[model samples]
Target: MSGIYIHIPFCKQACHYCDFHFSTSMAKKDAMIAALKQELVLRKDEFKGDTIATIYFGGGTPSVLTTTEINDLIATVYSNYKVIENPEITLEANPDDLSQGKILELSQSSINRLSIGVQSFFEEDLKMMNRAHSAKEAEQSIGEATKYFDNISIDLIYGIPGMSDARWRQNIQKALSFGIPHISSYALTVEPKTALATFIKKGLIKPLDDELAQIHFQTLYDVLTKAGFDCYEVSNFGKPEFYSKNNTAYWLGEKYMGIGPSAHSYDGKNRSWNIANNPKYLKAIGEGELPNTSELLSLTDKYNEYVMTGLRTIWGVSLDRIRSGFGEKYYVYITRQMEKYLEQELLVVTYGHLIATKKGKFLVDGIASDLFMINLG
Candidate 1:
């Protein structure tokens, strides 16, 4: 089965380290929504073979949209795609927008899962990130939301300046204490052109220490693993039965269509992304054209991507699948390269699956790079 990803590109306030395509202005929201609906219809035949099993509303903050707008988008998806009976519908929201009333209203929609962005439950951290919500709101909102939706997920950022390792640990314990089933924790990366980068460059704010971030990540893995939360992906942990189906679909090489400005669409063979500007996207779609560039994946590109995405999750690259897709020689080269990591205790082979070890998960990208074939084609 495939999935649907809806990108809502507006935020209440800009975070220091955010690099995702979004705007703080709402002037184009209505027209953008209409354009997104048009884009959905225009791309219905992108993936014709599989039925949609997951519907994701990801964004600058999907919660910022009115309930009517969200439902209309879902209605459009239903009009074009053959969605499964109980598709996992997810909306990525921020703490400030999720009130008890809003949570209750969300329950009335097709959405069944909520991924709340709770970067930190501390006022100072919130201020540092220029987040619109307060620390108290972050803690209280999730507690209130759990009463309405049990299939909840939270996003936490670690390794921020002034957020101690102890504080990060407390954050995880707090999430578990609140009975949140799925958690997506991440390291603070100061992307270029973001506020954090400027501040660090000017010495206005101290930069994040890589070593400390690594320590925090190790602490996270240990605590979550002992708490019965499985590390299904490098940056995500979930209870035994709480794996994110939408994200799982992406990892498993399933095709999905993304709608809205800066959204991406991937069929099994081709990948495309819309322009990052809302006005540009809306204008193009209004003219009955999809505002995205497309490129067909070369065989080498596909193998490299499989190695990158697959190695980050529990399912490592399959040599057999490689042999089948890329031929016997490619598999032979990969097996020879994997031996070095296996000897270094970075990868473990069992059940015919080459899975990344706990130690390897941290360096998964680097390891995958080493295993990449020059010309799988």
Candidate 2:
């Protein structure tokens, strides 16, 4: 099965910690939508051979698009691609965009699921991150969204340095009380060139401590797991039947077509990404060029990707799949290295699937690297 992703490259404001491709100016909004539709038609046959099982509208902020825009985009994909019956269509929305009317409109659309970006439910954290939505709006939006949609997933950010451990517990409690199905919480990351980084350097904002992040992470796991949500992937938790299928497909290295600026696509044999610059992308695509770069995946590179993605979630890399797909020697070496971690309580082997233990989930990158088959040649 394949997936389709559309990136809506526009935001109402520049968020302090956001490095995502977006423009505060909506000058090119209409043109970008037209260009995105055109790009879909231009590359119609890229994944035409596979059945499209999922379609994800990620952002900038997908909810910024009007209901008419949302409908039209879905129409284009259906007209151009082979979509499966009842596909898991998801939209990454922000709280400020979700009103009762908009939620009602979304309920009638093909979007069966929503991934709401409700970073926190407190005004202090909202201001700290410079998020466009207020805490009241965030809470009300979740309530409103659930009235129309049952498969609602809200995102929360933790370890903000401004939010204390007690406050963090309250955040978790608020989400749990909301009765939402899925929760994809994250530790605050200080990316280079983002406002958070600049502020920390200027001493205007405190930096996130590793110890604080660790504590927050552990607290999140404990709270969510006890609340009957599976820690299906690190940083993602879900109640019964609420895991994100679209993201799961990506982590599993399933083929998908990404249409828009700064989006990436993978087809098992090759990987590609579009130019992040909005104007450049629109110009190139408008001129009938694909406006992207591609790379053929080598055996070693593919193996590394597999290890990296698998270790980050509850599904650890399957050595059997590696042997069949990569080769015997590489597969043997992967399991051999994983055996070392297996002894250290970092990974657990159960039902023939090696999963990272709770401890291992904390340092997933390191464990995945140990099992990774690098291109040392």
Candidate 3:
């Protein structure tokens, strides 16, 4: 089954560490929504033979849009595409935007799931990250949202400069108190030209501590696992029957069409991305053109991507798949590279799949890169 990812590019305010494609100004929200609907209509035939099983509303903040605006977008999808019955629809939201009235309205809408951006339940961490919501709002939003949606996921950040182990533990405990079914947490990274990077460069804020982040990750894995959560993917934990279908589909290499500025698409061969600039995107779409660049994937590119994504999840690299799909050369190369990691107890071939061991979970990216084929014809 295929999926659709709609990127809402408007945000009420910018987070200090974010480098995502988004504009703080909502002056063009109407135009942007129209363009999004138009894009969906334009790309309806892209996934002709496949039924869309998931629809994800991700962005600067999907909650920023009114319920009517979201419903219209969904209506366009239903009108244009072959959406499956009861598709898993998700909207990424910010706590500040999830007021009780808004939550109630959304609960009545077609959106079945919500992914809240609650970075922390502590005021200092919230301020440090420049999140728009206060700690009280973070707790309150979740408290209210839970009454409406059962399939809820929240995002939390670790490795903030002054976040302590005790504080991190408290954050996890607080989330558990809400009985949230899924959690996606990540270590804070300072991207170039982001406020976090500039602050560090100017000595205004302390630099991120990688070692500390690693420690925090390990602690998180331990805590969640003990709470009966599955570390199904790196940085994602889910209780039984609550895994994110949209994310799982993407990781398993399902084809999806992304609409709106800075959105991306894959059709099993070529990958494309929309223009990141809002005005440029709108003008092009209005002129009956898609403002995007495309690339057809080569065999080498596909193989490397498979290796990268496969190693990060519980579903490890399949030796049988490698041999059948990529040829014996790639299979043999992978087995050869496995010798070193297997020796170090970092990876193990369990049931013909190369799974990362506990020792290698935090270092999966580096390990996958080491196993990548630099030159394959």
Candidate 4:
């Protein structure tokens, strides 16, 4: 099964720590939406024979658009693409946009899952991040949303500069109390060129401590797992049936089509990304052209990608698959490289899968990097 990702590259306001491509103005919303639909119809044959299992609306904030606008896009996909009978259509929304009226409208739409951006349930944290919604809105949105939608996920952030452990725990507890099936929590990273980075540089905000972040990660894993949620990915915790289908397909290396500005697409051998500029994208699409660039993947690039994605999920890298699919040379190299991690008990070989140990889960990215084929020449 394949998936489709539609990027909505507009937000009401820029968050302090965000680096994703987006515009704060809605002046080009109509033109951008038209361009997005055109892109979908243009690339419909890319996954001609495959059935679409997931359609994800990700971005600056999909909820900013009206339900009618969203439905038009969904109808376009349905008319042009081969979709499954019951596909998981998810829309990423912010708490403030998910009012009772909005939730009611969305419930009647094609969207089956709600991925709400409830960064934190604390007003101070919301202020620090410059999120559009307040803490009360965060709580109320979920409360109102659950009445209509059962399959829902909320985003949470940890490791804010002055956020204490107790406050973090309360955040988790507050989320859990809602009986929601999925939670995607991430550390507050200060990306380059972001307002958070500038603040840190000027001492306007305290620098983030790695040790504190690590502690928060552990706390998150412990709290969620104890409540019967599976920590399927590093920052994702969900009940077995509630895991994100779109993201899981991506982690498993399944093919997907990404539409709209700054979106990406992969089809096993080649990867491409659309232009990040909104006006440029609209102009190109209006000219009946694709504003994107692509490159074919080398064997070394594919191997590293598998290693990176495999270790992050419950499905660990298969040594046998590496040996057979990538040739025995890669298998031998991996065997040798993994010896150090195995000796340190950071990784374990169970059922021929290179799964991370509990002690290594928090540092899996570093471990994966160490095992990368750097001298791929």
Candidate topping lDDT? 4
**Where does model 2 exceed 4 Å of error?**
none
Supply candidate 4's per-residue lDDT for 158: 91
Per-candidate TM-scores read: 0.97, 0.97, 0.99, 0.99
> Candidate 1's error at 93, in angstroms?
0.4
lDDT of each: 0.89, 0.89, 0.93, 0.93
CA RMSD per model (angstroms): 1.2, 1.3, 0.8, 0.8
Candidate 1 least-lDDT 10 residues: 368-377
- Model 3: colliding residue pairs: none
State the lDDT of candidate 1 residue by residue for 98-193, as single tens digits. 888888899888889999999887788888989989888988889998888979999988888877889988888988889888999999999999
TM-score, prediction 2: 0.97
lDDT of 4 at 251: 95
Give Cα distance to truth, residue 136, candidate 2, Å. Answer: 0.2
- Candidate 3 regions off by >4 Å? none
Residue 329 lDDT in candidate 2 = 86
Candidate 3 accuracy as lDDT: 0.93
Residue 285, candidate 1: Cα error in Å is 0.4
